[model samples]
Target: MSPTKLLIGQIFIVFAIMVLGVWAATQWCAAMLGYQPQLGQAWLETWVFAIYRPWQIFAWWYHYDAYAPEVFDKAGTLAGASGFLGCAAAIAGSLWRARQASHVTTYGSARWAGLREIRKAGLLRPVGKFLGTYAGRYLRHDGPEHVMAFAPTRSGEGVGLVVPTLLSWTGSAVIHDVKGENWQLTAGGRARFSHALLFNPTDRRSAHCNPLLEVRRGADEVRDVQNIADVLVDPVPATDTSGYAGLSDSIDRHTWQLLKGVALSTLLGVGTEISFGDERSDLVRALRQSAQQNGARAGDQIVGRSLDIPPTLEVRPGWPLRVLVHRDVVLRPWRQGGA
Candidate 1:
């Protein structure tokens, strides 16, 4: 027989066998249940018997004659020896498959920054530029002493990310401007004016103000780039590619917004543990997209092509300062030269 025919024949045979088994079991149960058999002329026939009438089969099998053998045959009913065992085996096989799926695991990293290094780079100032939402978290056990901070992404900028400031609670701040035309710190005031000055974004190595990462051993949590953060001229890829390709553009907008939200809310989940410090750096990093602006709002006028410079993220975690320059920071020569 052809392979295809053999496969079809096997499937047909299996189904036929199941139906036949159910019929046989039903006849046995009926005999044991004291059922009366009805027919035109087969009442005395031994080979031919009703399959669906289990009660009748039981009655036939309930022999009281001393000379007759007390024997029962069950092959077709759902509760018969064969039928019950088949269903039990099927259920057991399904459970084992599910267990195997969970055992197939995958992995990644979260320690993109460290506590000590974030302190040395004067991260507080640069981080503040990007961290707009002022957050104050207090521990009941620590008394009046509490930590005031903000995530970079909460500043309402599209590039919002997952780093926090360490000192914002003690009422201390400084006015400094790096991306002039993108955002400016009002002289002697707390207001951060946007698009008021010239932005001198350049390459990191040339910018000198670029943040760097250092790795080391003796870590508790390990992952790719675990020992320390990697300082690349570019930041994390703004969009993820794991989703379906057919819906990419829609996914791009959705992905960026989701990343911004997560970067803002990751530590706000009520039970997150955090630390604070006084050391911080003023260096900040920003990424610019060719078709969109990173920090501008819907009403903000567009002068040229849109760009997405990621938020001025801290070089390490637990930095005292943060930065928040607009996306326009890319148009300056300082950009490539500083990267």
Candidate 2:
């Protein structure tokens, strides 16, 4: 049954037991006093005694007349026993229902993703990122969603998931291999199709990438250099003022600003050689100067060629003989070609 209906039923049963106990005690009291029992009077007495005169029942039992019949005593005992049992049952049922309500069951509610579902999600693609193994088969995730793995230290995460995935996956991946095991195991296989580089700071063989090189050299040069400096000099947030945390944070910020300034200066100084100009007008002026120089060179070549030609040769018209000779030379090949 639903919890609501079950709770309502329990309450009704408890109330019924309580009323029955009161009625049994009232009946016994009426018998002892040799008076007829009245249900209305019993209910009125119950309400008054239960609320304002709650101690009356115990006081009556302690000061009851010894002349009371044995049957009356037995009825009173039965009433007390029934009331105790009813209260206990209510308390126990409430606790049991609360426990059941709060309890969570994993059975039939949660299940691992099956092969068909995985394949349908395109996680079984050869180029997909490896998630883990399911039922002795590798499971991959091809979607763009992020995946995170949580495992305790000394687990088989590297051997089982990382290495296997790196060996089979053809796409690019960034791995955080603390022990350098992934590089040793999968480096050769990956090198066949991709350029693999390890960036371990402690190791001399690791490839180095200068963060400042990534900073763009333009109007936003300072901002870009500051961003790289921020990443390079990240400090832990201060948790308390008792230790060097505040001092460290101050030093880090100072160092970051100093590094940013130095980086900006270095890039600005070096970039001048490659940078066309600082402003659009400067670039336009440089382009105009280049165009003028190219035009001057072309003009100089034309003028030189014109000056190199003999003036008398150009003034006389002897082109008919030259044209006749060229025509004869062209026709001589066709005349001599015939066998």
Candidate 3:
């Protein structure tokens, strides 16, 4: 399929999953409360009615007290006024959050600008742009954070892996992980390199050994991290030569941010902990073995053969970010500088 059609299909699927998940949640809640599924509808209606009730009172106040009502339903009017004020505050809060999100992107930096030029290119431009940019994530916890992308490799032969580490979570984030260690900061001391095999998606004894692994021993910030992330996050081209050509326009990172944010929030809210179970030890061991195999290497390069496989393997014990089940479409080599 063409990039435009692919994007439209993905948008619909992602949104449908979100809508269905919400509906399912409501039904589950009702069941737990010993109520019928209709109760879910009733609850929604009640909430809407409550918000509408305040509006009704506000309308009453508006007409009666056009200027300033000296005499009226004091309690009802006060309630309506408070609700109206609350709604305004909520809107302001939302704007503040959006502004904050926008600011973060500013720090992340953009690969391109000039929105008008991009719009003129056509719809596929934006869709391909969307696919190219922001198709990955930075999952953070107490220690080093994991930056992942399920997109195709630069070669577009297979879905490759680019696992980088975010060192310190201060002014900016430093990203580098290799040989079972991460670059991190220490309090009242110099930078300390912590030993921990952060992310490994496959078994060592498996056919796809000798994976392409790179390690940066230096400490940097978010600005630096983006440089490495940019390469990994670039949308992989379809193997087929015809259906798609190339991408000229820049991808909008905000769309993925919003979708991932909502999906993650819902996943966490639902308390979904996808674990690899007792086999986790073996996976971690595989990572350790892989790390140990790294004998001597110059600077940051960890010499190993690249894995030729799709992004089907999981790193273990991570939440399901999103489900991408697309139909049959070959992956062609990505054109240099296209993303």
For each candidate in the order shown, give its overall lDDT on alpha carbons: 0.35, 0.64, 0.36
Q: Compute the lDDT for candidate 3.
A: 0.36
Better of 1 and 2 by lDDT: 2
Pick by lDDT: 1 or 3, better one:
3
Which regions of candidate 2 fall more than 4 Å away from where they truly are?
1-108, 113-127, 131-136, 150-155, 211-231, 234-253, 260-339
Q: State how far residue 108 of model 2 sits from its true place (Å).
A: 9.5
- Candidates sorted on lDDT, descending: 2, 3, 1
The residue-by-residue lDDT of candidate 2 on 68-150, one tens digit each, is: 54645775787788799799879988987887664334353455766788778886666666777667766777677987788
Candidate 1 local lDDT, 195-282, one digit each (tens): 2222345633223331112212225212313212222222333332464332212212223333333322322221122222222433
* lDDT of model 1, residue 260: 31
The candidate maximizing TM-score is: 2
Best candidate (score: lDDT): 2
Query: Runs in model 1 with CA error above 4 Å?
Result: 1-22, 27-50, 54-56, 63-70, 73-80, 83-339
Q: Tell me the deviation in Å of residue 159 in model 2.
A: 2.2
What global local distance difference test value does model 2 have? 0.64
